[model samples]
Target: MPVERTENRGADELHRYYEVYETIGSGGFAKVKLGRHIATGEKVAIKIMNKKDLGDDLPRVKVEIEAMKNLSHQHVCRLYQVIETSTQIFMVLEYCPGGELFDYIIAKDRLSEEETRVFFRQIVSAMAYVHSQGYAHRDLKPENLLIDEDHNLKLIDFGLCAKPKGGLGYELMTCCGSPAYAAPELIQGKAYIGSEADVWSMGVLLFALLCGYLPFDDDNCMVLYRKIMRGNYDNPRWLSPGSILILNQMMQVDPKRRLSVRQLLDHPWVVKDYNSPVEWHSRQPLGHIDEDSITEMAVNMKRSRESTTALVKEWRYDHTTATYLLLLSKKQRGKPVRLHPEPAVCEDSCSPLDILHFSEDEDAVIVGSLDLSSEYIDDCPWISVTQQGFRGQPDGLTNNKNVVCEIWDGYGFCCVFCSKKDRDQEQTSENKENIVVQEKEVEIFALPLPRTPASSKKNARHNKNVLTTPNQNANAINSKPNAVTPKGKKNLLVIQQMIERLNQTMCFHRSRSLDMAGTGDSGKKKRGGKMFGSLERGLDKVITMLTPSKRRGLRDGPRKIKAQYNVTLTSQTNPDQVLNQILSILPEKNVDFTQKGYTLKCQTCGDFGKVTMAFELEVCMLQRPEVVGVRRQRLKGDAWVYKHLVEDILSTSSI
Candidate 1:
């Protein structure tokens, strides 16, 4: 008889079942590559984890795998199987050919409202499932979000996934998340509810999806933290009322007020004009996904898993699973590649310092000499711009406390606004010459480079005066009429003229209507009482004229006679007057009143950021202003009513 070859292979022989191709991606402890099934020509993503890299954190890796094993959702990345060998562990997952959502968003600059709604809906669905599984995906940035060929989102990267301590009131204290998407509670180093923290990240994602850039961002960590804590950001005017309403609900600074996943599902924007996939609707409703239900399901699953484990242990003659892992590793043999630990930052002597000063000649000051002796400096790839000699600076907005600093190719350049606080801290000429750097306060502002030719020329001139003019005070530099570009000035003038003309036309028409109503007649004013009173009484009279007898009597007349007899004129509150008064009181410096709403820079915050507000202007002018949404305040009274936005309004229409 011919010798029979056995087809059965143990878990250690995973390489026989699948063929690993070239590496596709990599992280600290794992490398992902394309793999093909031996039995079928199906392709899959194989994540190979080095056993040695796990060391003490092996349990966490196992937990992540276990969590993924239990998860089954259309929007979530699917984990097919786990295979272990002597030196490595392999995870077979669904292949997402479209790559990361980060790259997609970057290519598009920003997504339109329709596309954002679709992607965001899928994200929320995945998040709801993850939460219901009693797992918190601590890292939920765009990099963790993937896309398939069909344009559907696939949530991946479960390395930071974890179970909450308890059913309710459970808090996670780990300061483990991306700073850009981290919640305020997490940033403060305080314990935070995992679900609430996840909601906060969703808010950041939503804002970034609609706007091209992040809502809160800065080169300085402390500045970014402060902005996040204060919930300071501008509302993009292009967003619809519904979109703005939803964003406001999700991005609450207070976790308690932030919309939960269930609430988000039920929100108007999420549901409006939205047609859910059949699979999505077939799953349990959001209301069924509560903490208690998840807790019970988790307990049951754990119990079943334990019983299965016991049965397997008994079949293996009471040998623990850990022993099997060692046996499999020994069978495979050979050590995996060892990765170096992350490089440490040197905090000691010869620190890298960047200083900025304004002089008249448009020249930048570079004070620190590179230490060629230090290994750190030798390894540093920073290309010195000073070697190229001095070049003219770009012209742009230059004002007090409005400076921006940016770094390119390891060299730092800034267009900074010197504040009174900074100016007050006077230094000796010798001290200034030495370029002493301070740790606590780095006076850096990263002004964005001008894109247009006109702005480029303007910025170049402005930067010359800002950086090169040593004797010229910031006040003198700020006093130039060209402080704002001629084009910008012209746009503001056009917008203002548009508003003024609209106001004028409305006022003229309103006055004409009032005269027709006899309110403008001095003799009729005494008889008419207050303008509002006449309006109310006229409305009541109009209502009375609509009685059955009056209707029959009016029906018999010609169309013109019936029209004249059916309606009565009355004085009303002019929207033009309301807007005119609000416009009159607003500072001309940085305020722009547009049809959508108004935008103003907060003088009180001082470089914190700009604030944009959008409302139905006609509705606001007609009703009692009162308190509005998202830090909006309105002052209502008999004499004058105006909504007071952030104290200082900058005239720049760039926002």
Candidate 2:
């Protein structure tokens, strides 16, 4: 899914290198374009980041460059260059061969078990390398994972990598990240380890993939948060045993317990040899993990909170924007609770005024009494993150419901959403026989609410940055800033080579002009001035978003990028039979195709052929949809059984 660059033609002395191509995409913060390097005659993806516009968070750009250089793997998105000037920062990266995986999943109705495995294995392998290097990919989701021509995954967007040990204990007061996939603890206004956060997201991604919807979902965010905090979502029977196993571990309410990348790699779902369907068969019905586990996580959230607090405090600077201490407080008198603290930059706890117990370990915070009927917590929350710090919760506790909640905890503030339920609360609690299930204690602990001290001396607001370690009468619990430059072996050349290949392809049939910004003599460039249409210029842009939108629907016929191509489904074809027939003829080089809906291929010859069931589908806990939402199938409260789909892959290949 290479970006299609329309030429931005210009003339200048610097134009000695490849010509400037057209813009692929643009947002307020940055713009990306496709270019052909004159020296190498190669096509490349170039992203320009505006320095002043990134607000005060300059390190993110640096983090991205640093991460790309140090981390390299086949499945990992390749980084090519980091060109920095006093005014700008230019990042050159290897283009992802395919478009956003988000769009991909939407189009395919999700991949088969084997397809999911191929994707997971590649991504986890990339993550394993990333984690082993002593860093955490604070942000992980479908959007960041790019696919190449071979359907290989490449993890991109390292703007939030946290050095596990070496980080200058700079307190990161400003919580920044996507909320939908944030871990439960994060939503609870607690400190979280970077690795722990990543794993939580992995669970969300997996759930969405398997179920074709978010696991714990709500249009109203508060409702969503409540669901997550409960940590009591349902896993559908349709999910494979292997997938269920990984989802169980990755989405653990507690970060410490959340499966590590390495651990996940070893799980039956991730490991290549394990048969998912078979394992699900012999297993007994899965049970709901003790609801207490979520509350337990609330207790363990100390690490993320304390650590992030210490990091922020340690990095206190005199800059006005960095100063300001806002304490989170709850209104004692309102049904619709709202919080208005000293207003400053921070991660505000997402909970409303309703009092509730939360277990720190699982990062699961359960709150009761939300008016979910009208307004849902899932729709919004009381607090939100602002550049200055945390603002009042986004949505007050307006919706009324009587269930616990889940949250996305950030540096200081948090966002909450409802989790997918085992069944609506009515069904779960209505049955007298299920009393034992309700009796299980949720391991929530009482925490000291941060409040303004009425009597304690008010520390004068100095440079608002609170050092992690204490002052002169001190120990080093904080990090100081000299702005250490992270050094790493650069992998920019690989990106350059790939780009060059694209440039050659673009030029193969068309003579396209180039462009430059701020240069005096501008050159005139017209669309399709070159012979090859979008197909040609697009190859030059590696990191492109490919969707049916661009191809004018499947009716546009099959489209090919580089050597990569997609075939169409026709009315005459028997979907299952076609898939099976296609897989059967593989030359033992390109496929280990499965009828259950996946295929493995030999790279050299593209011939690994049709596969037989190494495993069968066994629902560990198959329940009615009303019972389970989209949680992994393993913990479905006991009941699951077995099937093979490899034959379809063989048949499909021939079509």
Q: What are the clash counts of all predictions, listed in order?
A: 24, 156
Q: Give per-residue CA lDDT, model 1, range 522-621, as digits (tens).
A: 6344322222222222122222221112222112211111111101111233433433444554445444444322211122112554433321122121
Model 2, clash count? 156
Q: What are the per-residue Cα lDDT tens digits for candidate 2 across 421-509?
A: 31133123333221112243221111111122221122124112221111210111113212111110011122233234334434432
lDDT of each: 0.47, 0.40
Q: Work out the TM-score per prediction.
A: 0.42, 0.41
Q: Which candidate number has the best TM-score?
A: 1
| Residue 95 C-alpha lDDT in model 2 | 51
Q: Cα lDDT for residue 142, model 1?
A: 77
Please list the residue runs of candidate 1 whose C-alpha ends up more than 4 Å from where it truly belongs after superposition.
1-12, 54-59, 275-655
